[model samples]
Target: MVEAVSRNSFKAYDIRGKVPLELNSTVAYRLGRAYTELFQAKKVAVGRDVRHSSPELVKALTEGLLDGGCDVIDIGLCGTEQIYFATFHWQLDGGIMITASHNPQGYNGMKLVRANARPISGDSGLRELEERVVTSAFAEPVGAHRGNVQVCEVMPDYVQHLLSYVDIAAMRPLKVVVNAGNGCAGPVIDALERYLPFSFVKIHHEPDGEFPNGIPNPLLPENRDATAQAVRKHGADVGIAWDGDFDRCFLFDENGDFIEGYYLVGFLAQAFLGRFPGAKIVHDPRLTLNTIEITRQLGGVPVQSKTGHAFIKERMRLEDAIYGGEMSAHHYFRDFAYCDSGMIPWLLVLDIMSREGKTLSELVQERIDRYPCSGEINRRVSSPQVVLESVEKAYAPGGQIDRTDGISVEYANWRFNLRMSNTEPLIRLNVETRGDRKLLQRKTEELLVIIDGFA
Candidate 1:
């Protein structure tokens, strides 16, 4: 049995915690054993970010993998997606990525994938792995079936795969600024642009484990300033920035305005549906009407799935969805084995601009005007269930209620969703009204009052 630890360390999606206090070499070693035993994986691909603590944790994890009789292939200092590529490219039985994504520098985590890049989450296999880790119930190998380590570079193929999705030759000359936020995206973007025709302006494009600028999460308003400022300063056509692992991307228009991810979803859905008519496109429940309308207009089917990457990817694979998107900037594609890419969305959007001869703002303006939303507001509350109940009761008389992903109250002219975060003690609220920004603001304020009342 693995050693006992705090339940707080085992998160909903993966194992993440602060180093030394919550996560340490011991924990990593135990997790390695548990993962290998659970998957019966003979070979595992391992990768880490440019964090100072990453090397130590990776070494411990690798030692445990070898102890569990699983061979390890170490891809040093790589983004999370490259580990996914390594898993499939090398035909490894499983993969483990040591990264906290856009989390603070003090935090670290691991994302696991089964053979063929299949995700292992709490519901699928992570819970069992956690239990094994807590108990340390690993069996010893019988013979000399020890694992070996190898190093291979997977970036060239990954970049080529991303570029394959868009036609760079047909792209218009675009002045683009990419802020890597001093994260792992630097090397990948440098390699990718060498073959493209666009004029690229790079910022914070070097991997600094110290994170001198700030945490690389673009969802936070403060972190977006560098990219937004760059867009205006350079008079660029568009600006793009990625999180720590480069899993999701955020965008700014020529005017340096932050474009919401929902609008991007609608735009990309339209683009893919144009090519694959009548195909299904998946979207999270947070922004339903815009995606549904856009998909219908483009002669495609719109399917709403629960939030988060794992759920979206599962639905995409089951339904063979050509594309899947979340209000948060995660965009998944069928061409990429139903995996989400921080790189591909921007590429496709640029292609859309070149083909339509329209600016990014112009392409998404209609959808944004039609479905004005008060971007997701998070409230810390003592009782999330009670707050949800209050909102449901208050709105139940006027419209339909959906508990699909969260508590979604729908009316003819407007709708909103109030859902609790899986990883934190907060409830996320997203409100949208039909072509009325003021109404969305009003409803949002009212919902905030109700949520605050529970506090």
Candidate 2:
């Protein structure tokens, strides 16, 4: 039986835990068998990130898939999205990427998806996989029917697919800064270089499993300074940095100013709507005044989706939205099989700058001036639910309240979304003001006081 402690790794979306203790070869092997049996998958694509334990995890996972009587397509060391692309592109039944993805070097885990690059979440298949992994649900297969393993490198086609999103000929020769954060993004960037004209200033580009510099989580303010400094030193047009597995990207302007991911929703929606008029756009409920107003101004419908990828993707297909953006740096495109790509957002920003004859700052500066935000503040408390209720009671009377994904309270000039994280024991908050940075700061401080009192 799989250890009861191992189930801690099975989160609302994917698997993640410390290596050799909560997750290891045995857990991966059982997960592989469970995924195969749950989907009755005939063929599965697999890939891995730069984590030290990834190779061993992939090996054991593949063995389990083979023993489950499934054919395996190993796509070699790659980012999480590579497996997503291969699963849909090669018409495989499912896929898994061995990655801890922005976690510390001591951790390792898996990201799984069904055919067509659709996610398998806790409600969908992850819960079942967890139970099976613990119970060893499926019996062993015969040797003759064991699956065969094949290796296929699919980066060429993936690059072409990314480039197809823009008019490459119209792209200007601009100095670009790419901070891979020493994850799996370097190889993909090198592959993409052959097709593009931009000169890249690479930092932390090499894939080192040890992560000597630091864990490659760009969302942390501490992790962002290096990229911002690189942008300033080189006088580049823009700087882009990705997390460990390169699924989400953060951007900085020419002046080394970090652009809030919330503002990008409006900017990208405007860019896409200019071409596909009246197309729908999906946004999370965390911060909405800027997005809703921008979509309306651009003559596009705005749909609010739950804060997770699986929820957003499902909602996108239902609404036929052209794009979706979360404040956490996840940008989903309709053309990219309704999947989020760290690579696509920067490329689109480059295209926007080129086509409009503007710098990255010029493109998003106005949005910043119009709606300044308190970029996702996280606080650990004794009781998250009680804190949430306290904050809601304090402000819900004067503001319009939304409980879509979290408790979002909207007032005339300012708004905030306060909720507990799905995977962590903490209360997360995001506050924004309509062209009033002072108001944003004051409200955020006031809310923090009420929340801290509960804790």
Candidate 3:
């Protein structure tokens, strides 16, 4: 007989659930056996974030790994990117990171990576692990080959790796502020500033599992004000913040205005293309026009990909894209094994601003004006598919429609992507126009009505 596993625990890219109930020692033990059997990995590196429940879960996971005849190197209390770093740096057969990644306090999850930092998702290897956990068919080890857990600190070397990507000597002296939101980013940012030519004002720079300033998610409007306020109050040239695990970063202009990730995509796209001319750049389908226009203007190929990191990274590797980005702030680099980094994007942005003698806002303003967007609006509904179907049915007769990731309806003047959230029961709508805010607003409203009508 198979042990029951909660279906809700299997998310789009990872296994995320509330602690103890959905993800506990039993689940970890089963996952360890499944991972070892699936990858045949003899050695694995593990890292965790600064969450209260993380230590206990890490112990449970390590025990399972040992039981499965694998050696585990526990790089204690690090970011998701650091786990990726450890996998490649230490030549481990696989790596796992215990992080909810900007989710609330009670939430905890795992990010698995194959050798060379290759991600393991549901379609790839995660589903197999899930099956093993559900079936409880893990084999017990017979011999005395139990895995040993060793503590290792890789932050210093990881910081050096980050600095290698940017020319710190050429970086002009500038005032910057970083809000880590009391997450794992504080230590990395602290080490990075020590080697840079800029002065930094750090806020919420301590690692507090309590999340005193709410969750570290910068996507929420409420979470951004503090970073913006710090930038303006300190007369800083730029402001940057990261989510809990620091996988995605948010930027603010000198005047404390939050810069949209779409514009940053163009900015970084132009920078990477300038270095590797004619290289392919991949972007999500949500903000196609901006990336398309920028990549064309910069003499590079712009390829549209479906949202989600798994899709973006796979597409990047397939197209040999030098870089990939989404409007939701996930940025992936081919140089980093097509992995998304919350640290690399800001470093490149700062380098661009420093080298060009352009303000952060000035660098991205033209692109923003060229492509005005409605951002992303979420609407709750019982049936997300029904809502998306309704929106598609409403617009399909009059416009060009594509269901690449979601339903994208396009006309000559404007376009919109109405897709259902993979993790939540909601429809995400993003509308953009050539240069008209009014048209964007109108279409956004119409799309909202179509979506709500289904409810």
TM-score, one value per model: 0.97, 0.98, 0.97
Q: Per-residue lDDT tens digits of candidate 3, residues 1-455?
A: 66776656777799898887888767777788888888988999999998888888888888888888999988998899999888988889989998888877688889999998888997888887887778866666766878788888888878887887788888999999999999999989877877899899999999999988888998988889999999999999999999989999999999999998988888889889888999999998886888888899878999988888889989998999999999999999887878989999999989988999999988888878888999888888899977877777678998988888888888998998888888888888899999998898888888787777766
Which regions in candidate 3 have their CA more than 4 angstroms from the true location? 1-3
In model 2, which regions exceed 4 Å deviation?
1-5
Cα-lDDT of candidate 1: 0.88
Question: Of the pair 2 and 3, which is ahead by lDDT?
Answer: 2
For model 1, where is the 10-residue window of minimal lDDT?
1-10
lDDT of 1 at 38: 82
lDDT of 1 by residue, 1-455 (tens): 34676555688777788987888898898888888888889999999987888899999999889888889999888888888778877788988999988887788889888887888888999889888877766677545876778877788888888898888888999999999888899998889888877899999989998898898999988788999999999999999999998888999999999999988998899889888999999999887889999899888999989998889989999999999999999999888778788999999999989988999889888889999998888889998888888888888997988887879989999999999999778999999999988888888999899999977
Least accurate 10 contiguous residues by lDDT in model 2: 1-10
**lDDT, candidates in the order shown:** 0.88, 0.89, 0.87
